[model samples]
Target: MEEIIDQNEHVGIVADDLTSAADGAGAFLTYGYQPLVRRQRQASVGAPVVAVDTGSRLMEEADAMRATGQAIASLAGCRHLYKTIDSTLRGHIRAEIAAAFKASGRPRLVIAPAFPTAGRTTVDGIQLLHGVPVAQTAYGHDPVHPARASLIADLIAPDLGRMATVPVSATDSDIGKHIAGASIIVVDAHSQILLNRRIAEITKHGPALWVGSPGMAEALAAVVGQSPDRQTFTPPNAPRHILVLVGSANHLSHAQYEALAATGASVADRAEGIAKTASVACIHAPRARTADPSKVLCALVDEADIALSRQWYDAIVATGGETMSALMERLSIHTFTLVKELEPGFPLGCARLSNGRPILLAMKAGGFGSVMTLCNATNAILQMGRKST
Candidate 1:
């Protein structure tokens, strides 16, 4: 990857094995990411390893890795972890593994930087570290494979300066379990070469499957192959929501409200209109306000949380099946749909067309009163792994 996206000062390298020479890149500089293979070669045998197990699949460090590797690597200081509840014997197993990860003290959050399966190895790290929920990435199967994870991250990052950003858009093959009108991606966009290499790094699991918005996702499908065969699932990054969906009666919990504020989505009434515009001074639980006019609705939707995310959502929409469907259709992307029978909480469902493009839909069903607030967040950690092509 570093060679693929090399700049004079910056090079982006994603290697399958955990060695410095693994990718044909030269030795690590004082300030570059290195995989473990390189580290083992350079480090003195008696030197303390001082490994920082991120509780993940563990990519080789920029310094530790070369183009070669016995293992992959990961970044450091990511905030998030997992805690496993197992039987007594399993607990003992966990404790021993934990010892190698951290010192005597319990680590705060067990951080999992979103890997292929989130890896059992990461789970064991949590037992060694403090109590952190297994952080998971939301991206699903990508033909681009190993490099796609970081590629998606780079797209969503505030700065697009790490490497050359080439936007590869391709049409998906129209022969799989995808929505109608959706096109799969071909060309270098869905780097099968990279995916295959990364899979070798994780385990022998075949690959994951990501099915959602027909447009971009189809691109991935085209590369992974049109085969109906399945294995592990490729997660999808929760769409960076630009608008906030709020019900008149639905309220935002203190924590939920804070999360909304943190992401910077907007607040709207069930009627799908904005209550405040211009500058939002405070992010408190807004009084349950109903939508009165469509203009108000449009204005509110326009100003919702899209700005809060690492993206400016095309639009911040208020809630309603009609509006949502309309938006999904117009955008030609999948919109989340909530089943009418599903209970309140977080609901998940997808709408697919016949092989062309799959529409990602989010809908909430059942006695959903018009008094709740809706906001879009990271859903998990910084494991966002997709962007509309």
Candidate 2:
């Protein structure tokens, strides 16, 4: 927050979901940008970086594009526009980018859906997860927007008309040739090195619409001359208990929650409620995929016997955007202080009471993080809270 308080310049990011928006914004936070995620499609006032979630991953393609356009329209004055796509070819990928490009009024758009660190990359135009086609991985079973193919071009062919394709393997001269002629260029990047190089080349093409996941965002930030400060803060000691809420039906999220529960946290299904003797608790959402997830999350919050005013828990770890959004709404929390991210896709923030007492919150996307990410996040948040006090 101190890093961007006196700055007036802005960079904009448009995302399909809440976590992705935060992931994009988190990249800038390291570079001294006070990042804020706005739920509504509105103009940014004071934040140096504002990532807006279109919240259209599950909506119809037409509706998704419309929401995306509206989000981009609010970013009219931003010096640079970033369209954050899912590393995997999920959601209305092509449509959203098209909308972003159109609404942003940029001359050219460059797209790369790769995050090498997370094992999601584009090779020969196909999206691969840990060396396997994304369509062959656990993401193929996603309830909404399941990946049906690995080809990046085919994945978004429905909306990509005549865009040029430039493999990261292409020489700088070759890429430049294509970039000079095409309105949109899709690049193939299998590693961070290649992606960074491509970004360097793209940056040379002047002010175009840059699009990709967090990896691309980081590279773009560096291209724009933003370097990160790698200092850790020592938080003051505070008594902190935590509640881990699992509301996403994604297999990865369920596996992560199970891994967290295995670490001996008292596990209580929403129906069972929190146990009297449990200090750290896991509020498990129902396993049935057919059930209404929002309703389940709402019930969990409504039924929580804990007292927020008393600050019984030091932090609340929630998985999935919808779940976190619903939890915040039910708790009447409208704003949060953007703390540093725990991991690439796992962001932690602090919501506060009117009196400014902080309610520590940690969140991640449904398909992000390792098996132990939840457990790691819980410990990290506890440590962060203690160090900050």
Candidate 3:
């Protein structure tokens, strides 16, 4: 596909969580857009592409809608708008999407929540995770916001109006026919090629609100074209101390934490011991299935805050959105300047505390990374620090 350059086009991305917001913005980094992820809806935007985390997924349905609507409303002037949803169909998908649609005032809403790289796909309007219906996957049993169904149409609220489903094999004209009268259209995309084709065809229909995960962000970035001046990354000075915080209850996250622990990283028994005993220390929530998520997150944040008070770490790695969000809030950090993505869903960036101290941060969604992801991230952080010195 040929690149379409539009110097005046600015993109706005709205996500239900922080990790999603960072990864969504990180998608535009390849095209030379310096992306910024703001924790608040009204934060200043210094980059062409800005992603905002509404922190709405943890809210009740009504509050989620209000938060989502306010965030979209704040981004009213952006020429292009995208909403990021969980690829596995978790959270208040229906309510938040409805709010974004109402706020954007875009004539058509196109929904394609496929991330082929992660084995999430949509086929015949059914959302699948690794060839199994999402409702049958681990997400269905999520401690919070479990998915109730795999059918895309079934997941969306009926009040949103009739939705047309476009198959992967559908021609451009077939997509056009579906877009003409449908208020919402769900496209079936099982691969990168199919997803790209669907996005390319949809963009031709003029301005419409696009919805999906990071895969959709990548496609939109392509449509927006490469920037005239690509930004170069300058690795920050190596961190002398590193902290890994794991607050996700996902089995995958637990496994990743275990893998990192096996590498001999000290597991912190007390906040006071973190700064004195080890250069690399890990703090994780209990792995019991019956652990209360809210209490667990609060404990992690309290422990991290105490560690920071004793000594500020140069680099911190956090798993799960709730964990990262809670930590950032505790530090009074409202914005994250995305430098690069260490991996597809793992974004590395810098954030300033209320006292104006900058710290390197690497964040990942609980369910997204491999078992070795945390270990690899730690190694990468150490290497970056070493190269700079």
Q: How high is each candidate's TM-score?
A: 0.24, 0.85, 0.92
lDDT of 1 by residue, 108-183 (tens): 2111221221121112112111222222232123111122212222112222112111122312332122222221
Computed on alpha carbons, the lDDT of every model, listed in order, comes to: 0.24, 0.72, 0.82
- The TM-score between candidate 2 and the true structure equals 0.85
**Stretches of candidate 2 exceeding 4 Å from the true structure:** 1-8, 41-43, 136-138, 155-162, 227-239, 250-264, 275-279, 304-311, 353-356
Q: Which segments of model 3 are wrong by more than 4 Å?
A: 1-9, 158-162, 273-277
Candidate 3: the clashing residue pairs are 238-385
Q: Candidate 1, overall lDDT?
A: 0.24
lDDT of 3 at 147: 85
Error of 3 at 42 (Å): 4.4
- Per-residue lDDT of model 2, residues 1-389, tens digit only: 11112123457788887778878887766765556676644334456677777778868999998988887767756777788988877888777777877877778778888899888888777789999999899788876568776776664444434678887658987877777667777888877888888888877777778888888887777665553433333332363678778877778888887887688776767525555445567776777675466577776665443534333676778888877777776666655545688887787766664556667777787767789888888777667656667
Q: Where does candidate 2 have its weakest 10-residue lDDT segment?
A: 1-10
1 versus 3: better lDDT goes to? 3
* Winner by lDDT: 3
Q: State in Å the error of residue 368, model 2.
A: 3.6
- Candidate with maximal TM-score: 3
In model 2, the number of clashes is 7
